[model samples]
Target: MAETIEEIASRVRELRELSKVTAEEMAEYLKVPLETYCCYEEGKTDIPASKLFEIGQRLDVDMNLLLTGEEARMRIFTVTRKGEGVEVERRRQYRYQNLAGKFLSKKAEFFTVTIDPMKEKPTAYSHPGQEFDYVLEGSLKFYIHDHEIILDEGDSILFDSSYRHAMEAKNGRPAKMLVVVI
Candidate 1:
């Protein structure tokens, strides 16, 4: 079914709550006031398309998935051409609300994320879970528990998510990483 703006807003709110991010925190992340962010969630204020996309990225969900309940699933295949290659195909599922709710429902949760280099620093995702992040591509710097770690491709780290954490590309290049919560 085609989704409406209201549905998208509601889902955004759901995901935000599931992420255990308070409205005040979100407001700070968005560089807006708490009441303004609250209005955006309540649908009292219309979110610009650009800002909407930003929010989706921050939440690590496809903009479409947030607009619609349907998830984005794809089969990605990779092949190397140097004769020392293997064909690798994997199914990836991007479920915005579903995954958010799953993590929120659990005492501990995990996430896999990709950040666009053009965007601002990602808002911190916090909860009672322990989180591990492994950099897959590009460079990223993580701010966790008031400490900063610059991660290059293939670098990995683990920490408690209950403490504040945020991430940004260190070299102005897009970053890809896997986050596991437990």
Candidate 2:
């Protein structure tokens, strides 16, 4: 069975308890309000991918442990067949399929992202890493800080994820891209 948001939240809570960390500490680490962090822990709100990543990192565990409840045992290489990667439902407008979720000690996280068409660009988010996005289908409006760039099929970009960034599907259609977070 696929992992549910509540199940992930329960795992996070259990891990936090085992690590002897307090909810207040996690909220401060994520730079989010106490209420917002509590909602994530309670599974009352969807947790952003970046925040989840941060939590996994701070807890000294791979994101696979958080997402799948399974430690990565593949040290050589793990191949995820087409349409076979793990899906992350972190946001309403974005759908992410994790490509290398089982790879141990990966320097980066690989994901295939699908962006649903929307009239307005959502709020930008930042994380402590670099990001690369390669457009595979349709068009995407990419925003990095004050700059906005339209990426068509086959186009790609690299930027610092620590800077505020957002992505929006264009032309009343969905967009697909390969994203690498390092």
Candidate 3:
């Protein structure tokens, strides 16, 4: 089942409180404006997965805990069968499936992200680390900092994620991509 933004926001708030971290502190940690972070905590704005992952790191919790309200327990390899990964519905135009949600102490987070065609521009986000994306189906226009690159099926890119980046489908069709965040 797809978790609602409100449910995720509530969990974020709960986790923050349980960690004894204040909203102001979280905003500082995330390097975002207090009001913007407040909007995320209040469910007024959708929290990007990258930002949520950062929050999980800052709070010392598994990212799955924020996405699925479940902690990863498997310390070794975990096998996720087809269509069995955890689905995260953070935006109307995108679907994120956590492929390694059951793995513990993961060095990199893996997800299969599907971007639906939209007339409205997608928002760019950046955090400290590296990101890799491989086009699995359809075409995608990747916006990294000031450069724009187009990728078709079987194409891939890996780069520093500290620079603002975002991707959207091309030709008004949905694009499926495998995303790995480190």
Candidate 4:
């Protein structure tokens, strides 16, 4: 069964309690206001994918634990069948399939991202890592820092993800790509 946002929120609250960490501490660490963090933990708001990843790292757990309620322990190899990845709807126009969510102690996070064309200005998101994107279908206009670049199928890019970045589907069509964040 697919876990709902409420379920994930409950796990977040439960895990933090078990770890003896206060919500305020988590909010401070995430650099968000206490109210905003509380909303996410209470299921009043959908938690962003980056924020969820940060939470998992801080709790010393794999992203699988946060998404599926199962601990990932495989150190040898893990295979995710096509269309079998954990799905996350992080934002309105973005759908993410976690390609390696069940791999434990991962040095990088893999995802297949499907993005719809924007209706307004795309929101910029940034994290403290590097990112790689390979377009698999359609076209994407990627904005990094202050520049915009158009990428088509089979095109790939590697960039410092610490700077603000965003993407929008081009030609009035959706874009799909493989994303690796490290």
lDDT ranking of the models: 3, 2, 4, 1
List model 4 lDDT by residue over 67-182, tens digit each: 88888877888899998998888888889998987778899889999999987878888776799999999999999999999999999999998788999999999999999988
Question: Quick one: best lDDT, which candidate?
Answer: 3
Model 2: ten consecutive residues of lowest lDDT: 1-10
The sequence of per-residue lDDT tens digits that candidate 3 reaches over residues 1-182 is 57778889999999999999999999999999999999999999999898998999999998889988988999868999989898887677779999998999999999999999989888888987999999999999999999999999999999999999889899999999999999
- Please say which candidate is ahead in lDDT: 1 or 3: 3
Location of the lowest summed lDDT over 10 successive residues in candidate 3: 85-94
Q: What's model 1's lDDT at 118? A: 46
Pairing residues by index, what is the TM-score of model 3?
0.95
TM-score: the better of candidates 1 and 3 = 3
lDDT of 1 by residue, 1-182 (tens): 32455666798899989888887877787666888888888977755433454576577776545655545453342222322211111112111112232111233323346556644455554554466778878898788877888999999998876687777776666677766556
Top candidate on TM-score is 2
Error of 2 at 94 (Å): 0.4
Question: On TM-score, who's better, 2 or 4?
Answer: 2
Clashing pairs in 2: none
- The window of 10 residues in a row where model 4 has the poorest summed lDDT is 1-10
Task: Summarize candidate 2's per-residue lDDT along 63-153 as a digit string, tens digits.
Answer: 8888889888888999999988888888889988888889899888899999999767677898888999999999989989999999999
